[model samples]
Target: MTQNKAAPQNSVETYTIYATSNKYNRPPPPSTVALHGMDLIGAPIDIRNHRFFHPPPSHLMSTTTDLIDKLKSSLAEALELYPPVAGIVEVNEKGEFYIAMNAENRLGTPFLVEIKDTPYVGDSETLSPRLDMLLPPSSSALAVKLTQFSCGT
Candidate 1:
């Protein structure tokens, strides 16, 4: 297996958010109360790191604005299939924790589209320090960030 090394910081000029998408095509219906074993496994913490990256195709490239638009549109469509992801978790009056599944998310997902201005370097980097900052505060259950590098990645 090949380990991907971090890209040289010299190539990356800066990272900035150009747009935000918090829209869902259709509101999610009220869902039944439920609990997850994983949610209970630890000391009731829910922060986990699962990161991956795909380098931009060498041939075709899209602008940052266009990439953000496409991502926003795709997220709206995806919510239709996975409604729960758009819901929230809460504990009932009885003091038992459960997921509300109600489509009533204050902000569906703090979806952020960021742009990284850099020279067109063929290779890519993983585990960027800025990646952590891109995520919203840990209060929300779901958060997403789509970063488009200068190479239209």
Candidate 2:
């Protein structure tokens, strides 16, 4: 992960929510298995990485509320296209992990959205290295957390 020049004063988790794909009723083909049991290499690599998105300033909406609203809406649509992410990892009778698609009518719940407030400090020395504490892990197949800087940058 890239380091940010501006560390936060502290992060306070303010909001959280569960979001599903816009179209959860549609199921994949019967033969479709979102993910087959992971192999040694794949499982190790997957466990080591976490994906997060931070769009460029130019792409940001007028206000934080607008940006958050668009993000939530776009997320639902994106999940619809990539339905496998909405599926859960479970073991079969033979004891293997796999992404079970369409086994349930609803997509995984609690997409963990968090809003953080960081205080402004006159000098960089006051910033804390607690940015990583903004979001906690969720059981949902997907999660999103939004961190707001004190300067709104």
Candidate 3:
């Protein structure tokens, strides 16, 4: 004989829902997965597959061409360090070369260049995402730290 399951007399009443309520145990600190990006606002430690956008020059070799090249290199090197970026850098129709971080999404905002490809080819003074840093590895440690910050994040 097949048993027939009876429908609950009430919709929510069938479930106590205590797990979602205060009765639920506070989750233990994330052990295996340590949070990173939540400096305060609880942003994910690492924005995996998160695409940020920036636009490039109307002309590739314009004042912004150098900027675009830097973006490409920074992106490539970042991919080396953070291997999840399994995509290519794209130069869109408007002449802005941005990374195709995802299929439907483009990274960086209009004219807001990211510092993935730009390097510090320096007399070695400072680290501007766009400008070359003058200091070598020996001369400045902070230069490396400052330059390491992503401009668009």
lDDT of 3 at 117: 38
> How would you encode candidate 3's per-residue C-alpha lDDT over 1-153 as one tens digit per residue?
999764323111111100112132443221122213332344213221223334444475454446555655554444333322332333445644332334233222211322333332333323222244242211211111112222322
lDDT of 2 by residue, 54-105 (tens): 4447555666668777766776666666755655555567765565555463
lDDT of 1 at 71: 65
Candidate 3 lDDT: 0.30
Candidate 1 per-residue lDDT over residues 1-153, each given as its tens digit: 999876534332222211123354444355744776666565544344544355545455364455555666676666555655655566667766665554344336556554555644553444233345333332345656555555544
TM-score of 2: 0.53
The candidate that wins on lDDT is 1
By lDDT, is 1 or 2 better? 1
Report the C-alpha displacement of residue 49, candidate 3, in angstroms: 11
Q: Which segments of model 1 are wrong by more than 4 Å? A: 1-28, 36-39, 44-62, 118-139
Clashing pairs in 2: none
Which residue ranges in model 3 land beyond 4 Å of their true spot? 1-62, 87-153
Ranking by TM-score: 1, 2, 3
